[model samples]
Target: MNFGFLKIAAAIPEIEVADCRHNTAEMEKLLREACQRGVSVIAFPELSVTGYTCGDLFGQPVLLAEAEKTFGELMERTADCPAVAVAGLPVAVDGRLYNAAAVFCRGKLLGIVPKTYLPNYNEYYEVRWFASGDELKTDTVTLCGQTVPVSSKLLFRSGEVCLGIELCEDLWVPVPPSSLQAVHGANVLVNLSASNEMVGKHDYLRDLVRQQSARTVSAYLYASAGCGESTTDVVFAGNGLIAENGVLLEEAERFVPGSRLVCCDIDIERLAALRRKTNTFAYAGPSPAFRSVAFDLPAYGRSYPLLRHYNPTPFVPSDDDGKHRRCEEIFDIQCTGLARRIRHTGARTAVIGISGGLDSTLALLVAVRTFDLLGLPRKRILGVTMPGFGTTDRTYDNAMGLMRALGVEIRETDIRAACLQHFADIGLEADDRSVTYENAQARERTQILMDLANRSGGMVVGTGDLSELALGWATYNGDHMSMYGVNCSIPKTLVRHLVGWIAATHADEATRPWLLDIIDTPISPELLPADERGDIAQRTEDLVGPYELHDFFLYHFMRFGVPPDKLFFIARHAFGERYAPETIKKWLVVFLRRFFAQQFKRSAMPDGPKVGSVSLSPRGDWRMPSDASAALWIAQAEAIRTDEP
Candidate 1:
C-alpha cells in the first residue's frame, strides 16, 4: 500500500533572461524526469517562463506574449506526464499584468494564483511593472487561448493531496495567501519563489519555510530561481526545499551549475491525523470566497520505495551532540521535579532503592543531583540495597560502590528471609517460581523501603521507567507504588543514556566506572533467582521482548496515534536490517497485548513529571478506561503478512 504518502518535488531549471522558449524547454525536461520518478506534484521557481530578472522587459508586449505561448507549448508537450505542475509566469487580466503561478495537469489548466504581495524595496521594484494580485478586478484570466479561474484563494485537490500556491514575495509578507488556503483544507502548500541570494538570507528563508509548514501542519514545497537569472544586481542560487510538518525533508545544495530537482515523500495521513488530534486546525471553516479545483493523478494504491528516514530508536537521539544535549536536558528535568517534591513536603531524607539496573541507577543519580541542588547533605539521602532471592553479587557490589562514591548513606537489607517467611505464611512452595513467588520478593523490598522512609520522615522515590509502566512489567503496589516517581516518564532506552551522560560529564573518577558498569549490566527486576552460573536467569527482553521495540511502539502509537498495520509497515522499514520481519511482528503483538491489558496499572500510576510528548501519566497526558478492549487492535495487527515485500 502507498500508506498515505504523497511524493512531491521542487524543480529548479536553468534559464536565460527573457528567453521563454529555452526556459520552457528546460522546465519540460525536469518535469518529465520528475514524473518518471513517481512525483505526483512538481513546482518550479517564480516567473520561470520569462525569468524573474526580466526587469522592465516584463511590461513589453512581445515578452508577455512569448511567455504565454511558450508556457502553453510546454504544457502541451508534457500532457502525457502524470504529475501536476505549478510554474510561475506573468499573467494579464483586464489590461493589467500580475505575478502569478499557473497550475496544470495533463495539458489542462487548473487555476491561476496571483501573487498577493509585491516587493518595492531596495533591491526590488516589482510595482513598476506588475500590480499586486490582490487588486485584480476579474476572477478569470484568458491565457494561451484558454480561460481559467484566477484568484489568490484557490486550492487544487487530487485524491488525498491538496495544493495551494503563492508566488515570490507573498511568503515573506506578514500573512501569506497560503495560510488561508491551508485553513481552507489545503494539505500541501507550494511557493514559487525567485528570491535572490544574500549572505544571511538563505538561513532565514529556510527558517521561514520550516516554521510555516509547522504552523499550518502541511507539506511545503519551495522552488527558487537559479544561476541563469539576470545577475546585473543580484545572484539567484536556485534553492529547492521540501518540508513536511516542521521537518525539512530535502534541501538542494545551492549554487549548483546544472538543472536539478529535490524530491521526497510526505505523509499526508500523518498530517491529517495531527490536525484532527490538535482540533484547533479545523475550528476555522472554509471561506465562501475560496474555490476548490479538482484534478486526477496516478493511483497511489501500490507500495513504492520510501525516501523518508524513520529513526528506529525514536526516544534516543541518533547523533552524539543531540544525544548529549537531550540527556542533559532530561536529567535536569528529573532533578528539578525531585527537588521540588523534596522542598514541598519538607522531607528530611530522600530514600531510594539502588539496584544495579539502569532505572534505579538513573533515579539514584537524579536524587543525588536534587540533594546537591537543595544544599542538603548527601547523608540525608538514604540509598537502600535490598538483596532478594534473585539479587546477584555483581549488582550488589555495584550498588554499594555507587552509593558510597556519591557519599550517600548506604544500607543493605536481605529480603530473601522475609519473602520465605511470607511464602510459608501463605502455604506456598518456595521452589515454585510463579508470579506469587516472584511478587512476594518485590513486595518485601518495597515494604522495607517504605518503613525506612517513614522512620526518617522521608519519601520513597520510585525507579520504574516508562517502558516498564507501558508493558505493565512492575508488580502492582510493590515496585509500582511510591510517593514520587522520578524516573516514571523516562523510557528504558533513554535511562541508559542519561546514566551514561552522568558518567561522562559529572561522575567523579571513583564513581564513573561503577556507573558505566551498571549501564553495561542487563536490565531486569531480579525477581527470579540466578542461573547455574550465578548470572541473571530471567532476562527481561527474553520474557517481555526488547525494550527498544516496546519504546518505539509506545512513542509512535501515543504521539501520532498510528494504527497497528501502518506501525508494523514502518517498523519493518526502520529495523529491517537488524530484526527479521517475524521477530518484529512477534514482539509487536506482545507490546499491543501488554499495553492494553496494563491500562489499570497506568490508571493508578504514581504522580511523576511528564518529560516527553509520550507519557502515561493518568492525570496528565494520557487517560484511558481500565477495561478498554484490545480486540480490534489485535485483529488488525494479526492480519499483517510477514512474507509480503
Candidate 2:
C-alpha cells in the first residue's frame, strides 16, 4: 500500500522534429498509459512538442501555432486520464517567444512556468531563438483561447503534493528558480531539459539533480530530450531521473529504442517531516511573488502498491561495494577519533573487552587500527576476554584466536569467581539468574577493564553499539560506561557488516577465519549460563528482540522523528516477508518503551564519533530529557491494526 506516497513518472516519447501532431499523439499514448499505472504526475522533456533540435525553426510562427494546437489536442485527448501532466512547448506572448512548461489536468491548463535561464554559450545557442521568460513583461499568457498564469513563480498544488516547474537551463543557473520555489513551499521540483550528451556530462547532470533535491529536501524529476531529437550537431540520450532527498529512486535507460516511462513513488510525508525537522529549510518565508495553483488528483490510499524499495537494514549499505566503502570510511573515522583522544590524553595503551560478538569484535578492530594509525605497538592494545557463566567454547576460542592473530596482548579473566563472591557479599543467591545476577558479571568485567587500563595508563574503549544504546540493552555501569566508545553511533546491523568487511578486505589469512566466526556468532552478553551443548543460552534477540528490527526503529524514530504508526506502516513494508505484522507491532512497542526508558543511558553516553545521520550522543546530534514519556507513542503504535493491508 502507498501510505503517504505519490507515484510520479518521467516520459521519453519518440518525436519527429517540428511534427507537432505526431509528438502530441505519442505523448498522449504515454500519458494515458501512465495514468492507468496510477501515476499522479508525469513530466515530458523540454520543447518536446516541436522537438528540442528545431533550432531557428522555433522562430517560425506557423510551427509555434501548430505546437500550441497540438498541446491543446493532447490535453483534450487525455482529459479522461487522472494524472497531472507537464508538457513542454514554445509560447509566444505579445511579440516575445519563450520556452515554457505547461501543467495540465483534466484537459485544462493549470499554469505555465517559463524558462528563466537561456544558455547562450558552448555547443548551444538557445538565446538565438527564444528569449528568457525573465524578461517577459506580463505574468499571464493567452493560449488555446484561455488565459493561463505564465511565470517562473507558479506552483501547482494537489492535496499534499506541491510541485514547481523549471525548464532546461533554469536548473544550471547559480540559484535556480526551484530554490526559491522550494522555500515557498514546493515539495516536488520538475525539470525539463533538451541537454545534449557529452563525455562526463551525464554523471555531472545526475549529481546536479541529486544535489539539488538534497539541498531543497524535495523530489527532483528530470526528463531530457531523447533519441528522436535532431543529431545534426549533438546527440540526446533520453536521460530521465527521479530523485528524493539525495537518493536517485529511478533512472530511465539511456538510448532505449522506443518510448519509455520511468516511474517511482515519492514519500511526500517523509519530505514534509524532514522540512519540519530542519529549521533552515523554511528559514526564509514564502516569496511574495510565488502563487499556488490548485489541482485535483484521485486519492491513493493503502490499496495502492508502493513502488519504491525500503532497505530492511537501513544502517548498512545494500550493495557489497557500497558496504565495503562505508566500512572503510567508518573504520577511518573511528581510528581518527581514537587516535586524537589518545594523543590528547597521552595514553600509552588501549584497553578493550573482547566478547567474540559483533560489537566487541568491531571495537577491538577499531582499537587495533587506531594504534596502527598512531604508530603505537600493537601489543600496547590489550584485548581482555572476560568469560563468565554464559561464555560458550566457540566464542571464547574465537576471542583468543582473534586476539593472538592480531598481535595484541591477550588477557583472560574468568569473572565467575568474582561475580559469585560479589553475589554472596550482596546477599543475593548465585542461582537466581536475575538482573542482579547478570549485572554483577557485567560490572565485574568493566571493573577489570578499567583497572587494567589504569595499570598501563590506557583508556577503556566501549563495545556497545547504537542498537544497544537505543534499547538500553547494556548494563548501565558495566558494558555501558567507557572512556571512549568507537561504536557509539554504529548500529548492530552495521556492526555485522563492518566486521564482515574486515574479514574480506583488511584481515590477513590468519585473522580472517576468526573474524568470520565472530561475525556468525549469536550476539549475547554471556552473563547467563551456557546450555548443555555449550551454545549461548541467553540470545540477545530472544530477550530484547531482533537487532535488525530495533535498529530500524531507532533510525526512523530518532533520525526523522517518525511517529509510531507511520513507523509501523513503513516497517511492515520493509520487513513484510521476513516478519509478521503482529511480530513487528510487538517489537515496535518494545522499541518505543525501551527507547524512552533508556534515554538516561544515552544521556550519559561516552565520547564517540558521529559516523552517520542518527546518533544518540547527548552532546551531539540528539539531545533529549531522560524523563520524557513514551505513553503517547505507545498508544499510537497500539492503534495500528495488523489486519489492514
Candidate 3:
C-alpha cells in the first residue's frame, strides 16, 4: 500500500438481529467484494456480528458464544482479502462483556477496540449489556487461534496508514476517544456506530462528523448500523459517511440498503505538512500510556480505478435547491450591505461602471436590488458605459442596452481622449505598453466613476471579485479602491455560473439572449486592441490560465494548507484527460506564486461581506504574512512535474 494514498471504505451492510451466522456471512460477502474492488481498508457497521438491537439476546450465553465462534470463522474467510476489516461484537472480559471492534487482517486477528462510553439515556440502554473501556481489567485476550491485545487504547498501524477505531456512544461524549487517538499518532479515524434515527438527528450526525474531521485534521470514516435489525424498541436507519478534512465525500440514505462503500485516497503527505505547519498539533511516542499494535498488508500494488468524488464546478452549488437558496441569500447580503451604506451616507442614487462583463454585471444587479429594497426609483441606479482605446462594439452595445432596459439613467462617456491626456500628464509614452500604460486607463475610468458618484450624490460600487484579490490582478488606486465591493466574496468561476442562473431564471428573453452570448465570449479585460481578425483580443486565460483551475488550487491549498505534492495528486485524478500535466503544472506554479505575493493586497482590503468560508478579508478567515516565501511550495511543485510517475 502506498503511504501517499490508500482506498478506504465505510460499508453499511444489511444485518440480522441475534443471527451471528447470517450476519457474518453477509458481511463476508461485502468484505470480499470490497477487496476485489481494491479497497485497502474497510469498516462495517457497529455490533454487526450480533446486531445493535439484540436487546436481552446480547446477554444470552448461547448467542455470545455463537458470535465469538462466527467471528473466528470470519477472520479465516477474509484471510487473504488484502483489506483491513473491522466488525463489531461483544467479548467477555473480566466480569463484564465489552462492546468491541474485532480488527482482522492477513489470516490473523489484530486487536479489539472496546467502546469507551456506554449510553444509558434516551433510546440507548447500552449500559444494560455492555461495559465501557474504563472498566476493563485485562489488556490481552485469547480468542480464535492467537493471543490479541483487546483494549480501547489499541491503534492499528500499516505501512500505508495508521488507524484508530471507536464505537457508537464513544463519539457522542464530550471527550471522544477519537480525539485522543488522533493526538497519540493516528492519521485516520474510523467509527462503527449503531445510532438510532430520530427527527433532525441526521443534521447533528453530519455536523459531528464534519467537526471531528476538522478538529483532528484527518480522514474520517463512519459506518452506522442498517435497517435489518431488531427494531423491537428503536430502529437503526443506516447512516454512513466519508469525509476528508471537513468536506463530505459521500453520505448514504437512511433506512435504504444501498450497501454504501465510499472510497477516497486520503492525502497523507498533506496531513503531515499540516501537522508540521500548525504547532498546536502534538505528537506522541515516549511511554506506552497508549497501547500500540502493528500489522502489515499483503502486497498492495494492485491498481484501483479512481474513486474520489469530483465536483466539476466546486464553487457552484451542485443541488438545484441549494443553488437557489445560496443565490437568494447572496443577493440579500449584497442588497442589505449596500442599502445600509447608502442610507447612512444619505446617498439617494447609486453609480456603477458597466462593462457588460460578469463582475460589473453582478455589481449592477446588486445595485438594482438595493434600490428596489429601498423603494426608490429604478432610474436612480445610473450605469455608465465608457468606451476606450480597446472597447469592442459587442460589449459596448450590450452594456448600453442592458442599462437602458433596466430603466436606469444610462450615460455614455468616451474616455479615449481623456486617457491620452492622463498618459501625457504622467509622462508615459502611449506607444510603450506596460503597467503604466494599462493602469493609466483604469485609473482614468475610476476617476470618472468616482466623480460621477459625487456629482450625483451616490456611491461608486466596486466589482473586483475574490479571485482577483487573491492574484492581485486589480490596479492599485484604480479598480482596487472603492466605497463598497458588492462581489468581493464571490469567485470568478462562481460569478459566471451565478450570472448564468440569472439569465436562465430571472432575466427576460431580451436580456437572457445577450447574457448567454456574453457567457460564450472569451474572458478578457478588453484592454488591448482587437486583432486583425476584428475579434476582441487580450484573453485573460492565455496570460493566467483558466480561473476554474486556479480557484480549485486556491480553495484546497489556502483553505486546508494542503501540500503541493498531494494537491498535484488530487488534481491529476480530478482533471484526468481534461488538461495536460504541463498545463496544470504551469497554472499551479502561477497560483502558488501569486497567492503568496498577493497577501499584502488582501491584508489591507476594505470592508466587504464574507459570504463564503474561504474569504481573504483581514477580519474574517485568512491571515498570512505579507511576505511569506513560496520557495518551498514551488520546489515541491517542480519536483512533482519532474517526477516520472
Candidate 4:
C-alpha cells in the first residue's frame, strides 16, 4: 500500500450452471488479469465455483465432488500470485454444507467466512441449500485436505489492510455482518453476491453499498454474478462496485455482455483517521476474537494510478444550483446566529464596519438580514465606513453607495488624522509604512467602531473571515478582535462567491450594482497609501499567496490532517496544469508556517457558528498550541522545492 491506499478489485466472471470446471477456469483467468493490473485484493460473486442457480444439484454428491476438485485447482494455480483472492463456493463441514468465501494469498488458504443471513422470501430460497454461519459448532473446519479457521469473525490481514467478508443477503438484512467486522477492526469489507436483476434494484443496491461503507467507515467491494448464469428463471446483471466512505470510486455498468471487473484505490489512512476522530466509533470491549491469517505482499509503488478524483475546490460546489443553495443556507445560519446574540445580549442596534471588501460586505449583509428578521427598523443598524490612509475612491464610493441603497444609518469615521496623531504619540514615523504604520490604522478604525457601538448600545460585528484568521492576516487586538464575528468561519474565496451570489439573487436592484462592484474590487486592507492613480496598493493575495491555494491547503490540512508530502501530491494532481509543483510547494510551505505561527490569533477567536465541516473555532472545532512548531512541516515542503514554478 502507498499512502494508506490499497488497490482492490471486484470481479464478475462468466459462469455456467453446475459446470464447476468451466466456472473455475473463468475465475482463474480473471484472477490472473486482476493480479497483473496490480490488484492486491479481488473478490468474486457468491457460489461462483458452482453457480448460484444449481438448485437440487447442490445436494448431489457428483456436483459437490467436482466443485471440491475445481476449487483445489484454483487455489493451486493462484498460489504463487501476489494478490489475495476471495472466491465463493459451498464447503461441506462435518456433514453440514456452508456457503463460504475462501480467501487465498501467497500460495496458502487464509480463512473461510460463511454467509450469516440467508433469504427465504419470494424468488429466493438460500436456506433450502446452504446453512448460515450461525449454526457452526466449531471455529475450525477441514476443507480440501487443509484445516482452516471458518466463522463469521474471520478477519484476514495483509500488512495494513484488514479484510472482512459478507455474503449477498447478509447485506440486505437490518444489521450487516460487515458492521460488526468494521467495529472489530476491519478497514475493508468485501461482499460476494448473486442478486437477481429486477426493476429499480440497481439504485437501491448502489445506495446500500454506499451507505454501509460510510456508516462503517470502511472501503466496500461488491462483486455479483453475471449473465452467464442459468437465466431460466432470473437474469443476473453482474453489478460490481468499489465504494469508500459513501463515495462511489468505481463501478461496472450493468448488463454487460461478458465478465467484468471494477478496480479502485481505497484510502485506508483516511478511514482510520476518521474513526479515530469519531468518539462513537471506538471499538466496544470484548468482541469476538478474530482468527487472523497473516500474509506477505510488497507495498504498492508510486506508479499505481489513483482512480479517485480529488476536487480542486473542496469548499465550493461545482454546480451552480448547489452553490446557490449553499449560499442561502450559510446566509441564514449567519443571520440566525447574529439575531440570537442580539436577543440574548438585549442590544438595541447592530454595528458593523463596511470597508467595501468581500469580508465586510458579507458581514453587513448578515447584519441587515438579522435586523429584518428581528423586525427592527433599518436605521437601527449602524453601518460605519472608517476610511484609512490606504482607502481608494472606488471602494469608498461603493461603500457609501451600498449604505445609501440599504437605507441603514451610515456614518463616516475617517481615521487618517486620528491614526497619524496616535502614530506620533507612540513615536513612530508615518512615512515608515511598516507593520507599525499599518497596524496603527487598523487599531484606530477598530477603536472608532467599538466606542461608537458602546455609545449606541450596540455590538461591534467583526468582518475578519476564516482565511485571514488562518494566516493571521488581521492585526492583533485590531481587526482580529470583535464582540461577535459573523464571517469568522467563512474562507476568503467563499466570501467573494457569497457576496456575488447575494448580488445576483437576493439584493435589490439599487443595491446590486454596488455589491457587484465590491466583488470586482481587489481584496485588500488598504493599510498603505494608494498608488499615484489612487488604486489599491497592498493586495492581500500578493502578500500571502492566492486565497484559492490557501483555502485548499487549509481544508485538507485541518479537515483530513493530511501529511505535507501526501498533500503536495494531491495538490499537484488537483491543480493539474494550472499550477506547477514548485508553486504549490512554495505556498504549501507558507501555509503551514503561517497556520502554526498564527495559532495565538485563533486561540481567542470570538463566538461564531460553524458554517461548514471545517472550522478554526478555538472553543469548538480546533484547539492548538499557541507556540506549536512548524519546523518539521516547513522542512518537508522545502525539500521538494527545486525552482520549477
User: Over the full model, what C-alpha lDDT does candidate 1 score relative to the true structure?
Assistant: 0.89
Better of 1 and 3 by lDDT: 1
lDDT of 3 by residue, 1-645 (tens): 543666788887787788899888888888888887778788888888998888888878999899989989988887878788888888888768888898988678889899988988877788899889878888898777678998888898876478989997788889788888888778889999988888898899999998888788788889999868767777788887888777687777777864556566666666666666667877534434678888775455636666766664567788999898888888788889989989999986788888878888888878887888799998998798888777788888778777776778997898889988877887888687787777877888889999999999988888899899888888888888678888888889988887888888778866787777767777777777778776788888888888988888877776567777766766766777788777778888888888898888788777778787678887777888899998999999887753435
**Model 4 lDDT tens row, 1-645:** 777778899999989889999999998888888877788899999999998999888889999999988998888888867888999999988788988999887557878899989888998888898898989998887777788899988888766688989999999998798988998788899999999989999999999999999999899999999968888889998989999988788999988887778888888888888888888985666666667777765455766677677778878887898898999999999999999999999988888888988888899999988898899999988999999889999999999999999999999988988987888899996478789998988888889889999999999999999999999999999999889999999998899889989998889999999999999999999988899999999998888998888999899888778888878877877888898788888888889989999999999888888899889998988988999888888888878744432
Best by TM-score: 1
TM-score for each candidate, following the candidate numbering: 0.97, 0.97, 0.84, 0.94
Candidate 1 weakest ten by summed lDDT: 280-289
State the TM-score for model 4.
Answer: 0.94
Candidate 2 lDDT by residue in tens digits, 237-256:
99999999999999999988
* Off by more than 4 A, model 4: 283-286, 319-325, 641-645
Candidate 4: worst-modelled 10 consecutive residues by lDDT: 636-645
Candidate 1 per-residue lDDT, tens place, 80-132, comes to 99889999999988988989999998898889998889899999999999888
Extract clashing residue pairs from model 3.
Answer: none
Which is better, 2 or 4, measured by lDDT?
A: 2
Q: For residue 497, what is the lDDT in candidate 1?
A: 81
lDDT of each: 0.89, 0.89, 0.81, 0.88
What number of backbone clashes does candidate 1 have, counting pairs of residues 3 or more apart or in separate chains? Answer: 0
Candidate 4: Cα lDDT at 138: 88
